[model samples]
Target: MLLETSIGAVIRYKSPVSSKEPEFLILKNRRGSWGFPQGHKEHGESELETLKREVREETGIQFLEIMSFIGTIRYSYMKLNGIRSHKEVKFYFATTPIRDIVISYEHASYRWVSFLSGLNFLAHRQLKSILIKGHRTGLY
Candidate 1:
């Protein structure tokens, strides 16, 4: 059975954040939708390890450090067999590697948009809450 687990970061730059510069970086998918960079946990890897790996794989950058936890979200989706499986995703507030970046192929484009822009792109209401709370706390 595949129990899917993943992690994401709200990556912020070292520069003073601008309302126009966006507090969050979002990856645009093939579907024309946007989401955070995340990937599956590999064997023997810790959660943080997976988060870093996934972010780098998806966005071509590293996180200097994790500033805070943004909690987790879980939901279920069905496979071809019609048996539903659950995905639990952990999220964190992270600082970037102190360099500008380009994205990898998994995403067609990227945006460093404001919290409101990010919220507009994020498809899930629950993840939006996490992002909002993380922003309010100024965790990054």
Candidate 2:
């Protein structure tokens, strides 16, 4: 068994004037599955640095105000080469005012959705649990 670690964020956006609930950013991958922006940590990069870079690369939203680390999610899958691997994803709660996005080739589309909508959009139970933990942080 192999272990892999990645960093990601649940990016929240709220209009300063609208007084509405904060919307979360979700990316639809080429496979048509939705998830947050995340990637493997690069050499010599800290967790936060990796998370920031992943967010910018995927969403083109650079001004991330990282609120706090919510929690970690773990899952297992088999790689293309038939190797079983366990992955751990550390998720942070972040906020950004920018709404415009230039999605990278990795994703087919993107959306800014309400908390409940995000929960509905995500298929993995672990991801939904993480989102709920982030929402419970009282920052939004």
Candidate 3:
């Protein structure tokens, strides 16, 4: 079995004129599944560094303020080579003012949605729970 670790941000931003809460930025992968902007960690990189690089690479937004470390999620999946792999992802609460996003080729689309809408858009139970926790803790 192989273990991999990654880092990501639960990115949120406030609308200037809207009275609603800050919206979260979610990305839709080529497979049509929606989730946060994340990727695998590179060599000699810290978790925060990995998150910053991944977010910039995936979203094309460079400015961000990391608020807090949300938590970590773990799961297992089978690799293409018939190897079982365990993956761990550490998530951070981050904020940005840029609304327009330019996604990388890896994602099919992007959305800046409210907390509830984001929860509804996400298909993974673990990700939904992470959003719930971030909401309950008032990280947004």
Which of 1 and 2 is the better model by lDDT?
Answer: 2
TM-score for every candidate vs. truth? 0.84, 0.96, 0.96
> Model 2, residue 89: displacement in angstroms?
0.3
* Candidate 2: tens digits of C-alpha lDDT, residues 32-110: 9999999999999999999989999998988999989899999999999999999999999888899998999999999
TM-score of predicted model 2? 0.96
Task: Give Cα distance to truth, residue 28, candidate 2, Å.
Answer: 0.5
Clashing pairs in 1: 22-113, 22-114
Off by over 4 Å in 3: none
Runs off by more than 4 Å, candidate 2: none
- Local error of candidate 3 at 118, Å? 0.8
Model 3, residue 27: distance off in Å is 0.4
Q: Rank the candidates by TM-score, best first.
A: 3, 2, 1
Q: How many backbone clashes does candidate 3 have?
A: 0
Q: Candidate 1, which segments miss by more than 4 Å at Cα?
A: 16-22, 80-82, 97-99
Model 3, position 28: C-alpha lDDT score: 97
| Cα displacement (Å) at residue 72, model 2 | 0.2
